[model samples]
Target: MPDECVILADGPAALVELCGISTLERLLRTLQRCGITRAIILSSSAAEIARRLARPSWARADLEFTIHERPPGPTTVQQIVDLWPEAAARLLLIQGDVVFDIRLLRTLLAQTSSAMLIDSSAPETNRGKLCGAALLQREWAVARNGSVESALLEGLEQHTAEALDVANQPLYDPGLRRNLRPICFPAPALANKQAAERVLFDSVQKGTLDFPAWIHAPIEKFLLRYLCRTSITPNQLTISWAIAACLTTIFFATGHLIWGIVLALVVGILDGLDGKQARLKVETTAGGKIEHHLDSFFDVVWPIALAFHFYSSGRLPTAFYYLVVLLAGEGVDGIAKAIIYSGAGRLMTRSICATHRRPAKYLHLGVGHRADSWSAGKGSNCDGVVGIDDCCNRHSASSTDVDLAPKNTLVDQLTINPVGLVLGCADRFDEAVYHNVVFERHAELALEAAAYALFHYLQNKRLGNAGAAILSQNAERNETHCANFATIVEQLD
Candidate 1:
């Protein structure tokens, strides 16, 4: 049980920034989260690092951060022992470049004896490549005179070392062996940057809508990593994209089709970036609220503007009527979604009941009527019992149970499926739903755009113009799509 952690934050790698935060800052934050009250940061330029960390934004009032200049020759363990003799009894060693999960670190610290954190999933030869973190007892660090890895290996050989299985944990090692770059770093900083982007990417939520955009994920991730080094906030990005979307609408209205298409594509990419940046930076809820409203505004206004443009050009006569239909469909969609989420509590209760029923089946198969005996009067009466008393009790208990049952409150409901429950406290079911709905809406808009493009294509034909007929057919198709979505709402009702 380490009372304090010693971070070896010496080298260019320690200064590497991710999501606008330095590796040392990230490490300190993780240690704070793990409830480590004290830490000593050993760096070659201790004063410079300490000065940089003195900013009000980087302040951690609870944890005491001390910086020490790294000695010229001795190993990190040996230096720690020579400098802070008291911390030798229970010292936690962390390599400054390694980006890891706080939960994993806390789990490692829970061990009773000295332990080395290893990724078991790595190849047998690579398994010895520890993730730059280890728990060492006091005696283990005394007079150690090599690299941290070498010292850890010697300690393991000399003592009964417990290997902390970090195979499934989110541990990013940017050491000599496992250098995850491009996604984690730019071309120049590939060797030095901590693999924080890899950890952040792993943390990204995959929603129902995520599959359609899977092709663009790598591009978005690349751009996100690049943008993270900049001082731009996520909300600022959202505002910029909103302005671009508005410009896109203007371009469509002015009949600049190429500019409109280009801006629309840019808007789409920025839309993805805003959310990605927000999640990575842990932006405020107000930022997300602003994003949602902007998206909703764009979703309705963009198509309406395009339709108006077509009507003004004498391409489609019933554009206003089509706009009306679109608005009505969107209203119906909103109402339907609200109703569905409202009933989620009842559905969740039934789901829980179903889950509880499985064990009773197993118990019945194993113990027969004896299971019934224990459950007879205790309100566990499921079905098919043969006594008059049981029948009477079942009937009489049903009403009382219904009356006494916990109310199906909205708070108890989970909007997403059971698999989403695995996210536990980090579950953003509403956010997922919003993203899915936006994707579906975007798909509808794409279909409409295709229809408009087809109308133009037909009008340009040398022999005959079938633009009116094509537009009419597209209008009917759009209506059909709306009706199909409405039918889903009806079914849910």
Candidate 2:
């Protein structure tokens, strides 16, 4: 059996952009995450793609990418057989346009013979879609000459084969008959500007912990669509927002409360953009780290600035109390994060041990500690959303593994405090945390602005009544939103 996986990247689907990244890049990253170090990409624009992948961000030192000019008038299977006969028996075939769970690929790779994944729960029109992925034996691929769907069907008729039903698995195939659906795609149609905007809005993380940012998601999506088209980097967006946040600090310090509040909201929107842009453009680890550090600095400064504003307004008692609460709340949140990380480390250790013991079954799963250097040491912080390695790490412990056997110390620890596990290691947890931390802080800032206005009004009605009324109204809305966010977080826990 040949060791190389074959990716078909010649179709229109490969050009489609989902959540800011090209479908082809997503496919390549997925393969790398599965420990596939060699891949043969069949693309019509092979030269262009090869140039793009030469960049450090897309190129992997461990992975050797071979681009074959896709031949016209021949289907993917036939083209592969004609060009790469040596890989006939051992090819993992994947369509460039679709986004599928890594778990499905792991399952397919474990199969010894030709097999195809079918979504049993897909709409009737999509019944034979094959999800645009298959495990092809060299003999089978060479013997057929049609669409992958037709070839798979013919192979099934000719020989005994495995047709794994992955209807329950997450899949995002734009070629399917049905319209967009589910959290799997994370987007809608990516056909045009209007459609892309809808895709961005739809792609916003919608998990329980994401409730805090749900309100601003639409506006963020609007900004994201435009940002995606520009050469503006994620670091640029982060720096721009940081400047705005600094201006906001000046406004509050100078008693220009309304302007401060408005600028703060702008900062919030821009804050949301940086990460969205990063994920969309497939930015480097250094870019993300820069954004996080800048964000952390401002996260501390904003509250301190607000406390100063309150102090200067002759509300010493209120200012001190607010400062204490804000500081304490942040401290507690930090501790919670630390605990979650510690728990995740424990879970990962156990999972790695189990993986080593049953190497074959877990081969396509976690890459263990060695994965840390695969993508510039970003694997250690595998947020599970952006990087492919992280995504695999998130799902490394399969459902069967979770269900089996001995209730060890690690299992007992997880059972006793599932909050850490869910918050730290779940597939969507990092996304939830990314959006929630920014918007949640914005929510708290809104409340602080409202409190400042109310206190100012009480100190001098003539000077503050109008601002107080507006701020109070906005605060009420934000407070209600915060309450809803709290409820969702509680439910997640």
Candidate 3:
């Protein structure tokens, strides 16, 4: 909420590019996110830097930039002070030699009284250094002592991720213990851009990931390094994947199911990349809202397209595909996620559904449960039905049918909540990651669709929220190894 900011863009590293944006622009964006609408930048080439900053942001139409020519020092600082608005209550001082995490600025801005940003990391060995940024009283003159109250920077030295620090650190209440911890910083030096880029890219990853996202991460980042350098914007990246996903309709309608599925999976990778790039570049916009509608559009379109294909082929159980498309597709599930998240304040979780009892006998078929597969049958369709082997036998193929897929098939995994199979199967090392969602078996397929509805329709569903759930069968499915998002849970309680 700081309205006025003075950024020292004349510094040695100010104009240097890190991950396609200059250090100065990164400083401005940090201000942008903090709602600092008025900025005065100090740089010898101020006009040039200002020209590069005309890019659009959804929340930043009110943001204004002005430039003063000089290497910032006493003279330039005084000029900025003279030009500072008379009615402004405070001015935020910033150094433009490094890239900062926005959470760091938020921590600073949340302060009730102005204080200088301190490098409290090595206070013992460090004699003193100048403040990196500060919120100052607008009626400013050089402090005779050049002194400002120090707000302590607190976080575990062992923690490297900025988000972990931002999310996990506790700020105790007091006039002063009220201070929140700042997150990561990497100087934008020529020798350091690669490491800075890595740190920035890694910062955008969520605390939790599904099996698919975890497996896809390496390739995603590998491609992102080049894509970030291109002129293609995040919205364009979003549009590109959406168009590619829409083409899946063509593939499915034309009897090119393999291409359709392949393109669909690859679209998942692009979908993730667009979000990362948007965060990395701080380019949140109305286009982001568009991304969601496009996602919903494709989510419905692709399934309908598949239904069209199945219907045209005159296949058995074509009605089932239509039911799945109409019922389990995007819009309803997305609404479920929003409602659950709002009520529980728990993200990346599922709604209760299809409460059917598993046939305890064929548990290996993902009908029965494992120890980690936490729950009593949900109170819906699953409320009373247990030991459904009679039903399984009535509908399912022989368990030993060799014509069907082996346990690792991807289609079976996708169709049903494969957590049980993956947990119990000996072949499950990467089976959780690589299994297909459908099977080749003629008769067993019926049970797969039914169980998926009975189990995964809303039960323990983990799609969307950009894979914010870690996809575990246990009650701890929302938890992660590093307790990365432990911050939110603690704050709520």
Maximum-lDDT candidate: 1
Error of 1 at 491 (Å): 40
* Deviation from native of the Cα of residue 77 in model 2, angstroms: 4.4
Q: Which stretches of candidate 1 lie over 4 Å from their true place?
A: 1-6, 16-22, 25-40, 51-65, 70-93, 101-117, 123-129, 133-164, 169-233, 250-258, 277-289, 304-321, 324-493
Rank order (by TM-score, best first):
3, 2, 1
lDDT of 1 at 348: 27
Model 3 has an lDDT value of 0.49
Indicate the TM-score of model 1: 0.47
Deviation in angstroms for 304 in model 1? 4.2
Off by over 4 Å in 2: 1-3, 11-13, 16-26, 29-38, 43-64, 76-90, 99-115, 121-127, 136-149, 154-166, 170-200, 208-212, 247-257, 281-297, 312-318, 333-493
CA-lDDT, candidates in order = 0.51, 0.50, 0.49
The estimated TM-scores of all candidates read 0.47, 0.54, 0.58
lDDT of 1 by residue, 156-263 (tens): 556445565454332222111121221221212664335545667645423425453665667778888788777787778888998999899999887788999989
What 10-residue stretch in candidate 1 is worst by lDDT? Answer: 417-426
